[model samples]
Target: DVKVTQSSRYLVKRTGEKVFLECVQDMDHENMFWYRQDPGLGLRLIYFSYDVKMKEKGDIPEGYSVSREKKERFSLILESASTNQTSMYLCASSFPMGLALDSSTDTQYFGPGTRLTVL
Candidate 1:
């Protein structure tokens, strides 16, 4: 089974601090993503990396960045943490779904998520 783990389950930091959230997957997946969930804003993708040293900006990437130095590891960095950035951050990994439209193969396994609170 593919397992994803995060560096922290809950994090608390003051404003203007730098925060790093790490994610590791047991399976060698081609795509990894980071998303933040808020009360009504829903799950907004922050960043994703399809290959080592390659990354793409998602819907909301203003205060976020991502790194994929290794196949199974991805890191999400908050340049300057702020109170408005407080949310539940999720990490997901999925195999490279080819042309086949099977949704099963396109499924992404998610980690427990890290709840970050910036004060």
Candidate 2:
């Protein structure tokens, strides 16, 4: 089973603070993603990486950055946290796209999520 782990489950920080959220997948999946979910706004992708040392900016990458120094670990960084940045941050991992071997298909496994409150 693929297991994704987040460094923190709940976080509280003041505005302008630098925040780091860590994620790790035990299955050595090639793809990892980060998203911030808010009420009614839905899940907004922040960043993702398809391979080690490579990353792609997601829809809402304005105040966020990502790092993938190893195959199993990906990190999300908030350059300058703000009140508007408060949301439930999710980390996920999955097999490389286009590699659906069977009916189970390529499914993304998500972590419990980190609820960040920026005040």
Candidate 3:
């Protein structure tokens, strides 16, 4: 089965600290994404990587950046954690879009999520 692994299940931090959340996927999928999920706001994309050393800033990437040094691993870095940044961060991966098998059917398999509590 395809799998995505998140490095942390929970974290607590003081405001202004840098934070890192790691994710790895075994399937060699070409698309990886990081998103923050809030109760009423749903999932907001933060960053994504399509290939090694390449990254794209998503809609809400102001406080975050990412790295894709290897095909199987992706990392999300919070330049400076803040109380308002506290939320569940999820990592997901999928095959490149527009495949013969209907890639839209691709449901992003999520990590357990890194629950960051910025104090």
Best by lDDT: 1
1-119: candidate 2 lDDT, tens digit per residue: 66899999999999999999999999778989999999998888889999999999999999999999999999999989999999999999988867756443468889989999999
Sort the candidates on lDDT, descending order.
1, 2, 3
Error of model 3, residue 92, in angstroms: 0.3
Q: Specify the poorest-scoring 10-residue window by lDDT in model 1.
A: 96-105
Instruction: List ranges where model 1 is wrong by over 4 Å.
Output: 99-103
* lDDT, model 3, position 25: 94
Q: Write down the RMSD of candidate 2 (Cα, Å).
A: 1.3
Pairs with steric clashes in candidate 1: none
Model 3 lDDT on a 0 to 1 scale: 0.89
TM-score (all chains, Cα) for each model: 0.93, 0.93, 0.92
Q: What is the C-alpha lDDT of each candidate?
A: 0.92, 0.91, 0.89
1-119: candidate 3 lDDT, tens digit per residue: 77899999999999999998999998877789999999999999999998999999999999899999999899999989898999999999887766426554456777789998999
Return the TM-score for candidate 1, rounded to 2 decimals: 0.93
